[model samples]
Target chain A: MTAQQTLWSLKAGERCEIIGYDTTLAEAYRIRLMEFGFHPGERVTCLQAPAFGAPKVYQVSATVFSLDDDVAAYVQVRLEPRDA
Target chain B: MSKVILVGSPNSGKSMLFNRLTGLNQKVANFPGITVDVGTGRIQAMPERTLMDFPGTYSLQPISAEEKLAVGYFERALQDPEVDHVLCVIDATRLEKSLLFTLQVIRDCQRFGKPVTVLANMIDVLDNHGLELDVDGLAQTLQTPVVPLSGRSGKGVDELLASLRNPVMPDTNGAFANAPDALLRGEAHALSRRFGPGGELLVRGQARLDSFFLHSVTGGISFFLIMYLLFQSIFTWAAPVMDAVESSLGWMADALVPLLGNQVARDFTADALFGGVGAFLVFVPQIFVLTFIIGLLEDSGYMARAALICHKPLRLFGLTGKSFIPMLSGVACAIPAIYAARAIDSPRKRLLTYMAIPLMPCSARLPVYTLLIAAFIPAETALGGLIGWQGLAMFGIYFFGMFIGLLIAGLVSRTAEDRYTDLPFVLELPPYRMPGFKPLLRNAWNRSRHFVTKAGKVIFAVTMLIWILGYFPNYGADLGESWLGQVGHWVEPLFRPLGLDWRYGVAIFTSFAAREVFVGTLGTIFGIEGADENMVPLVDHIHASGLALGSGLALLVFFAISLQCVSTLAILAKESQSRSLTLKMFIGYFLLAYVAAVAVYQLTNALVA
Candidate 1:
């Protein structure tokens, strides 16, 4: 069995296909994640960290949202090809 | 005579369209993430109908307070036969994102047998970018009446109103399964691809700017700079206007003095009317500037990011990101600061945030601090003559008060009972837009007027009581010979250990209603005691009193922590909504202040000797 890489593993300016929420998370948090298009198969790209803190900006398609490190770590994702 | 409910995802121009139709201005925030305030007004075009504007929400599943409120409105509106139609306005530019909510509203409205229309707002953007939307095609696909309108310019607003006059219910299948955690992404995606205009340029433009603004390095620096500018303007810009207001009040008070025959009436009219209300009125400019700047920041869609940036540091102090704005707002005044705490999602965090606000060294404390600093702290330069000693003292007092607030927050979080529900730190970052000034100015004006009226009444009553107390038993012959003086003498022993006299005790007692009242109360006491020909400046009176440095320091510390303002207490009672919590804060802080003040006074008395 392979361990899944989460959105937290994505570095600055990286892209990934969101696998969905980590099942261990509470239902409210999971629902919120899905509500903002963080559901399975959505293409999410990490734009950058706000330079100082744990919260990083990610584009969930057209809408961009910032997630704290604690919560960001729970969003499972598959890494996409690096920009040439 | 049916109620037309305006519902939409936040910032979809729903409020704007409602405002246009009703000709009533609601607070239209640029920050779409904020909780919606239910605003109902009569529709100008259709006088027989009432229009209700709800908070922007994505779906029936509630997340934030606004969402909860909106969903509640939806259910109650369904129950009430008065709710005839729903105007679900969606941003035309972000159709793919908004269509999810649009589908939900359409489905629900149809189930309830209420007619609904889809106002595809921001259609003006399509015209500018050389783009076209298949409006009729979207109407056909959703089976809902779709009107391409710009809420900002009122473009195609007549078409929307005409449709509202005779709302044709959408033909959606009403098969939206009432799933608690429904994932409609697949359906929303299919709808967007079918009917969405593919407004890629706007999203791209937003991405380009967001990359720069949310960049780690630049974003942090810009956040600090903007926040600093915001606080700086509150202090510097407001001073001149505050002075102008104070002087005009004085002029009014002086003009009325000769008209009154009785000395007691004259003093009552002068101090209670002019001094009390005037003092509170002077703080309005600072509040105005703070609200304006905050509105601008919120409208620009940076408030959430700013809160996110603040989250890490605030969490260290046992607070969430939402506490940042309210805490910063505390520097200007705490009433609005208390109201601002509504943005916090967590109950515990909101309570913790409320505890810190009162100790934030509000602008009301400014006059008290300045008066004391001018009297005792010499204007000597320190640090190789670079920094003024008095200025440093002022800064120390403000920072020290904030330190105590943070310490209390940390303690509360540690002792607070754990909740079963784990409230997540999920914050919504709304897209930025140019704020409308008409509503922003009106918002600031309304808040200022509200503070003046609500808090003003309490201050006025308190001032009159103090006036009546001081005027009695001698008919304004002598303040030291009045009922207030007798009470002052009785309470003098309580403050005796702190080395303060009965007159100081009297001043402090009156000040319990409002902190700034200490200065005016003391001034009136001195004026009657000396029975002077001219009114002496309160600062000069303090200078002549030969107050011990230890006692002065003690009084300063007391003012720093004391739950002295009744207006703040009234606001806290309203905000916290728990009588126990409000009382606990007031009494708890009062005792903490008393002990701290006594300790400082005694320790200083020993050290100085």
Candidate 2:
């Protein structure tokens, strides 16, 4: 498996497993992300990248949330292998 | 009365369930954070019990002002002696994320020794998609009663009520109760994985819709089209109804005036009540249309996506995307728009949004805009009459108002005071559902009625005051010598820079009660000023009076930027929780409006010359 990439770096349709939070993330925001079901080891899929690409939608635990790139950068994830 | 607090994540159908259980028509939208105010109503079956609906939040830990508000209220309610039960609603289709919030709520309720019930809402969504949740197994795992129901279909409502009758507190020895705060997330994740619906079916269905809605090209185009439809509907659809209202009021006035024996009462009925208040009523239909269209956008889950689309552009203005909803609602009225601003996460952006709302050229401005445009601007059409010049002028004024709002918001948000402590932009996109027409109609009806009840009394009072002040002393013989005219003359120099006469000055002065009163005040002033043998429309009166093009344009600009509504100022004070901020904005906008009006009047006069 490759090293962690920020959730914002994943392309649409890319599937990834949450690894952990980047230490640089604000404490309050990190807690909020986790409470929104972005806990480590939880899987999420990139749903859509809106126009201009500041905020992107992602689905985790059947919940869809649009997070601005700044917020998305705090969530570390490992990309899943593409099915052939 | 025993209070039952309804708590849940945003867009979890919490408000809808509140409505179903209590039968109160509190606003529910697919967009999160619509319930910025606390809503309380008695349970339909049990009149003795009162249900409190709090704004939805992700967890007990809050990220925004409104979320903090909801959490604070919930924690406080748990300590209150009158509180009996807490219903933690979790979307069944989206179990894990919701369970995270549910766990926090259960833990909190346990700490307070208050009963908690896990309402597994939107199960019907799961059923239709051929999925299932083991409610009983989930109940056993959490050691709390889990009742499955749908807020949309009213399915399982009876079961929910039955469970409510004997609410049970989470067992003190339950797994979650003893689990530390950090561990509750994992427990919720594990429990949902075990008892949640087997597949990713719900996400798949919603993702299909998001593909088109969030696409770069189609999304932007649809967003503009929908917004244009919203703006256009307010004027185009409401035009006929406005005309009917105007004609009916005129008909009523014509029929009733002769029956009055006294001349003073006759003129009062005709000029004050009908001319002033009745003219204001003509624009109420526009408010109805605006509310209905906004409600449609909100309930369809498109408001969040619109915010997403607007986020980048709005960011350039030092505002976030959530500001879009309130700013657009401002186009309808500022009172609800101010309430809507609570949803914005950032304090600075919310303040900027408040500054921008009053400048949105609301429906109250429509009458003055229409009257002025008809008087000064030509009704000639271009493109084979498909586009009237008057319509183009209207668009220009509306755009100008919004542009000025954005400009001021952009400027103020960049100041040093607002530089620190900004909240992150995080919004949920709830799955799209067909908007409930019944609720939409009810909400629209309530909004219109609210506008009338709240603003109506003010308009009525101002009308009477203007009538008595203008009608007496000469008894409709000469308006120039009447009491209102005397006051108008006193204020005339203030408006002299805008090239307006005393009559316009009086109307402007009286309009501080509400912007729409500008029209009614003008109607009364003109009715007394002309004292015409035949009834003439207010637009023609402006034309016949030969109002300067500069003055007409100046009046439009003045109304566009001024913070004139007393209700808006009151709400601004209440919501911002700062009377001083309200005072500053009120004074600041009026000065800005005066300077802008003077500039417009000079520029138009110079260009024409």
Candidate 3:
């Protein structure tokens, strides 16, 4: 299988589509992810990543929100190559 | 009186709208047993009716404790015969995201046969972006009358008020109560696309700024600098205003001193009004400043980012990033800090946050700390006079309080069964807007006033009781011979293990109302001891008493850790909705403080000997 890219794999100016959430994560986290508009097929762009391995800001359509590295890791994403 | 409910998602300028509608007439009450604040304001235009502002929630699907409270209030309001009209505040910048709650409210309102008006708030947000919205088209689609207005600028507030005057019943024939959330979201997206203006240009502008704010290196530096300034402003900046307020109250007391014919009347007014309550009121400027700064962070949409910065470190202690704001503000006053905990989404984290807050070295503790340091710690300068011994001791005490708070939070958050069930970290980064000064300041003033009135009422009463007990029998002549002194003698044994005398016991006992009362209480006790003559400087009194250095240290430790403030307990009880938890925390912290104080006293006493 081809390698999977998570939200944490992206940096500032990088963009990707949310493939789906890691189902093995807690149910509450999944609900929050959806509530935050991180549903599958939604396009998202990485806005900024702070120095600490902390929450990174991302924008989807019009909504901008921060996702922690752990939670961001749960969201499977298809990323554009760095050279693209 | 008719009931008007204001419902909106978080950060929809719902509060600004409430401020515009109600002004300073807002009264904050607890929701029965819950810690939730129920703010009701009299509509000045229609004095017969009252407006109720609920906690901001995204949907009726109550995931978080805050959402549960908001939706719970909405449900109960639906059954209330008084609640007839609803105002659904929607952010104009993000109509699609807002419509979910808007539609949810409309459907529920339809169920209850109540009319609804769509308050398209923050229109100025759109106006600045040079975008235009077809308000009529959007209103037509939703079958609700949408009144476009900026809650910040108050541009269309008159029109919004006019709409509220004749509340229009929405033709919610198309709304379905059981419509799936996904369906609602899809419909909302479609509705925004069809009728609302395309508006990501403003949001894109926000991205340019977020790059700097959310940059790893610069963000961390900025966060520390802002927090440093926050604490500095609370201390150094508010000093002049605090001194002014104190002197004015002193002047008033002096003016009243001669007017009262009897010594009893003069002492009562002077001590109770001028000394006890006045000392507490002097901290009011700090509270105002604290709330204003927090309000600025909140309105400018920087709070979420602040939370993000603290998320990782805080999570180690079982708290989310959101708890940081409350924790920081806790350094100012735990009353507002407890209220600020409302912003935290997770119940467990919020509870733990409450546990950590009172332990924060709030400004109320400043008087006690300063007095103790002046009496005990030598005034030698260190680091080429950059830091005085007193300043260093003050820093140590403040650090100790916050340290204990973090330790408690870490322990509490770690041991919980559902520790990992944190609601996903998805704090919204709303586009930055210039903070609306009028509304923001109005909000800070109203909250500060509410604190003074509600919390102040309890403080004033407690102060009066302390004053009365301290004054009677000998009529301020012999405090040791007075009733309060007797109570002090009674509690003295309880504290004697820490080498404290009955006089210190009196100060400690009276300070249960608040920590700052320790100074005034001790002052009066010492005043009685000083040959019934002019009161000596408190530091000189302490020196002459030949009190053990260990006992001074013990008192500092006790005040640093103990949850002594009655208003804090009252707020904790209301917010936690568990009198048992409040009782448990009170007894537990007091016992903890006592044991710690005793240990410190013994250790130091042994070493000094």
Q: DockQ for each candidate? A: 0.51, 0.74, 0.62
Q: Model 2, B1-609: lDDT tens per residue? A: 898889998778897898888887453322223225677788989989888888777788776665676687788898999998898899898887788789888887777788888888989988898899999899887778899999889998898888789777566666666667688878888988899996877777788888888888887788899988876786688889988998899899999999999999999999888887776677678767777777788899998888898899888788899999789878877876776686676777888898899999887788778778888889798888899998999999999999999999889887748432477787888888889887778767876776666557766776687678877799967766888789999999999999888889988877786786677667767763432222237778887777899999999999999998766776677667677888999899999999999999999999999
Residue B70 lDDT in candidate 2: 68
Instruction: Give one digit per residue, the lDDT tens place, for model 1 in B385-473.
Output: 99998899899999999999989998988877864123567665666788877766776786677677666777777767877888797
What's the true lDDT of residue A60 in model 3? 73
Q: Number of the top candidate by DockQ?
A: 2
Better candidate by DockQ, 1 or 3: 3
Q: Which ten residues in a row have the lowest lDDT in candidate 2 chain B?
A: B27-36
Residue B581, model 1, lDDT: 79
Cα RMSD over interface residues, candidate 1: 2.7
Clashing pairs in 2: none
TM-score of each: 0.90, 0.86, 0.88
Chain B, model 2, TM-score against the native? 0.85
For the second chain, the TM-scores of the candidates in order are: 0.88, 0.85, 0.87
**Model 2: chain A TM-score against the true structure:** 0.89
The pairs that clash in candidate 3 are: A50-B216, A51-B216, B35-B574, B35-B575
